[model samples]
Target: MDHLQCKVFFGLVICLWTAKISQAYQTVENDLTDENSLASSYFFYQRPEYPRDCQEVQDHCSYTNTSGLYLIKPDGYPEPFEVYCENRQDSAGWTVIQRREEGIVYFDRNWTEYKLGFGFLATEFWLGNDKISCLTNQKKYELRIDITNSYGMSFYAIYNMFRISDEVSKYNLASLGEYSGNADTHITWCKINTGYENCTCQKSCENPHECLDTCDDEDICICPEDYYLMERLCVPRKQCGCHMFEGILIPEGGVHADSDCSRLAICRNGQLRWDETYECGNNEVCEIRNNIRQCYCKPGSIGDGADCITATDCSDLYDAGFTESGVYNIKPTSWLEEAFEVYCNMSDGGGWTVFQRRIDGSVDFYQNWTTYEIGFGSADHEMWLGNKKLYHLTKQKRYTLRVDLVNREGSPYYAKFNHFRIGNKDSKYQLLQLGDYSGTADTQSTPNGYALTYHLNQAFSLWDEDNDAGSSNCAEGNHSAWWYKNCDNSDLNSDYHAAWGSDASIEWYYLPGSNYNILYTEMSLRPF
Candidate 1:
């Protein structure tokens, strides 16, 4: 051959070789059974052309026993359908096959390709039309054959070949009758027990309980050893406690404490029990320190290891001289300047004493505001002398309060010294100044007309004056005075007084270079 002819011939040979390899690779094995040699022969045979005389099967085509294959349902009931194939005489040996289910022929196909040899048969078919062609719609369709040793068995085993087109793979829809003589048995506890004579099945439980094998009856579920049942739940023996203490389970009447030995925790009736006896001494109080309970003295009291005493016990020091010399400074500039200093010479009775003397050129007031209640003096101490204490000021009690005033820098307006026993330590205290003494006064009488007692029994109610500026006296430059009978006494034997600085009066305001000072003050209680 010439060079051009050789090249053309070689090209043709390459094309044919590629086509054969492609066909072999495109062939899929019949995975439904291992007893068949049908897959190998199916791809080796040449496919036939479309049948010209092929006709579409009608919607209602009667089926006859042809291929004679049947399947058993999953429920062990025999399926009523059988496989059938009808030969089309005009279609040149082509045939149409279908399977009937429930008296209905649901699957039908016409084969244009086949391989019949090696005691097996494999056919490629389509569900579309009688004219056999390559699958164009990609719908699931299958047709294959298997020859097995069960040749002498039932008809289902003899010609166990079948196919389902339309997205159903043969392996997925194949029945047990096609592959085996006996039906498939589902393995369950009851079935296993029934199959074996000596098999004893125990009850199954979801909870953590022991399963009991009841040989004579249904199995029973019971708690394990040392476990108790509560509401059908098994609880361990160690958890049978009333409550937990510090994350350690504690039984009823159990006592536990931390390693530091501060508080003793007790559990009772599934709860932590609290006892006042576990607290501090009678005069002392309990307090939390570093998350542990400890005993400490209450406010205004000092405590030793055993007992508590009033902080103001001045029995050791001699009596300090009393002073009525007090000067009211123009409403104190700040809380720090709102106080006066007094000196008690150790001649008077001890008790609470006050002294303000110049030490190192600076005034030492002998008072510590931080030690009092809310930065105010308590009954047990000498600090916060100006703080209001209505609880200590009772009805029918005679009280003598000393006062002194000095205006270091003279003022254009007159200022007064206002004393009050207010309901609370709030803005109401400033608006409810009870007694006002101006000019150079050293002593002021208690139960004055401006005291709270004065308003208790008045014909007009004090609450009605809530909106009255002069009565409420809450606004600046609108201060006034009021009086009422003592509410504590039904006989109205005593009266109380209240007063505030009026317009243009600098009662509580203090200005620099203008010293409105309270030089001294002394308060004493006496029996009525």
Candidate 2:
């Protein structure tokens, strides 16, 4: 083939090879980019067509998923051009103006070449000074530069405000606002020369001056003065700390308390160690539980110890500001009384104090009278909210009790009573009143209707304390604690069972047919 023909053929081959490389690199980059870096670029290659501009591309990232090379037509541009939509940055909405990787394209060129731009779009290339000016002039723009050295150490510099001048003034870097990055303060200038001649080895945190007498003929690069060598890069001397938490560099030998002040952390010789010395704030106390020191709000107060406030019942909290369903410390009594946590169901209407909950059967509810009276298990998980607490809470206000249950088939049913009250422990915490039941759980045609009504006016019973008027120990037969007459129409406190018609299963009878398996059950009460 002739020389001219051979050149054209080789060019075609090179273009094909580069396209494959670009595709591979893009695939790998997408995998490595995390959800946090998604803000760096918005438009993906999957976008139906070219966007109007880079700003248009950024607006799409919220609902769109992918990020790669895309075509864009700026406001004043005559024709559309290809540009990279980058989403692998700290923030979003960026049009990559320039990129240099492995120096595949030589940068040294005449003024004409720089103005018009050159090099491959996917690999290493400049988007031309003319195009950059057009893009920046159309809208406000910021500049971010990512750099990686020979040792694979990476750093970034960001200028809050940046703009390029038109070609009239030779395309000068017109406006450059505040500069911010994790780099040394003295990085204002870059000196390019042979290693030893630049006093590279003499630079150190203690002595940052140019070497005058101890100059050696070895090629070595050392950190600048008032700077330390970290990860083979020169960093500010002030940054010589241990990065043990959330990528924050702690000062050398410095101690800091965690967010909750539960424990203290000390940085020593680039290492971090935690101490059990808790520094709790006011209205807080430090205690050792599960082999770790923790801070807890003091009696009659509610909080995670760092900021404690006076505690009140769930109703008062709902009226105040707390509107989320979770475990909250509440005091039903006066200021002098201690506060305890209760799972408050703050949804639906709000301020429903949960007395009992069974989710996954993780907590064993088969207990004696004292255990049932004082309560057991975590407030965050499955637990009985204690009969004593129930009596105190109910006595404070006229409450209506509501029982919410979910069966094995994921169907929900609720039982509500207009008037519900419990007697003190002296009466075995008897269900003194359960007036006018209304709910789907009692919609059966049986003569003994209203499932929960069977336990009304009956004293609470446990295997060890049989207050039930049944022929047998009802709590022992069902392996649960509940108010029982002869037995119960709804044994919600029974062991979790998957099979139907099992006597030991947590059941709500008659309404859903006899002895049906229930997956979840909760009993809560609130004042009208």
Candidate 3:
């Protein structure tokens, strides 16, 4: 063959071979794409076994019905760890950060140990500082502490918002919102030793910024040279006693009366405890004000806490220096049965006895005649002092009635009467008398501003009682107990409505709008 023909023939053969190889490569790529799609589908259908928290597990894992020890993989955490899930308390889905039931685990640990965490989840455990920081930083968390004391009494403290800082900040508590609970006091327990055996630990109490040196190379905890070990806890010689009452550090052994002299607190063996030093009189109560437990005369009572005497009314209590607004026991007459509970509004001049009040929809005002005559609801919350109680209170002295109300928009208004009184059950507990009216609750129908006066001379009616002159039962129509003249010009004891313009809402008409709902209502009477 010629040289040119040979070169052309080899070129054609090489082109064909290249095309065949390209087609084979395309087929293999298509097979790999199909295999990849199948693998992706397989993973997509797989269950999410690793939950971020107990709440996620409760929501996603149907089999996880009961609360117990469970593994949770918190965000930013290295691996999953066991935590006690409390599904029974309050609602479900609570990750218990710390539990001290059997006291099998010693909480005394160094910084590194605390950061990494210790103890078994089944027994006592603190879910490590690092893990907690990671979990809390991921989202908002509420802390609920359930404590059962030595007396077998149970108490719970709930902090609405909680969070902590990262390791760089030593995992300090970054945020803690408002606290609410039944417990009277809040206490923070700081361990003296951060190791297995009780050992002295050097901590800079003077320099608050400096951290404590928990352990040494020999694995034994060491304290400052100046501090001595007391009851296996290290404390400075000057501050050997229990640290309490806003940094008031007592010596190793000390005894002092509490701020209010109500209790005697003793410091012994690096621990502080309290004993009741004084007991209140019959008409006195112990209350914690600004963390200081003190005894004071109750409502409608006077004298020192140890020797309180029953006062005639809220006015008497007001004169005796009982000024805080709250529920107080008032005795209208010398008779033992005449003493009853009433809310005393000690603000805005003081001594105003609240006979009827509705703040939240916690109490039901709709009732039978018997219920209205006696009373309903609690003295501290929403309550009606009762028609019988009201008659006795007003009969004791000439009272000025003040009706305070707040509309849905939170605008306050009031109606005041110079003279107010009610008749006994013989008159169906009628609102027998009302004097000159004045105030912002204007009827607009009348020349003067008093709107509730329309309800005067009318007998109080409940859902079961038909005393109104109107064709239909006013109390029944309004679904509340009230002094209804014809139907009602104003109804304070009506059903609490969230929105405005409801027929059954607690309302005062002709003030600004018709049938406007009142968010709060308080009918108080004060003796002039």
* TM value for model 3: 0.45
- Candidate 3 wrong stretches, greater than 4 Å: 1-300, 305-307, 443-445, 498-502, 513-515
TM-scores for candidates 1 onward, in order: 0.21, 0.44, 0.45
Error of 3 at 508 (Å): 1.1
Q: Which residue pairs in candidate 2 collide?
A: 39-92, 40-86, 40-87, 41-86, 41-87, 44-66, 208-225
| TM-score rank order | 3, 2, 1
- Backbone clashes under 3 angstroms, per model: 31, 7, 1
Clashes (candidate 2):
7
Model 1 regions more than 4 Å off: 1-279, 282-296, 309-389, 392-398, 408-476, 479-502, 506-528
Query: Candidate 1: lDDT of 247?
Result: 47
lDDT for each residue of candidate 2 in 106-225, tens digit (9 for 90 to 100): 868888888878887667777777777776676555666665433334556666566778888888788767877753322223222111123344443233343422454443544444
RMSD of 2: 19.3
Q: Please give the lDDT score for candidate 1.
A: 0.26
Cα-lDDT of candidate 3 = 0.67
RMSD of 1: 28.7
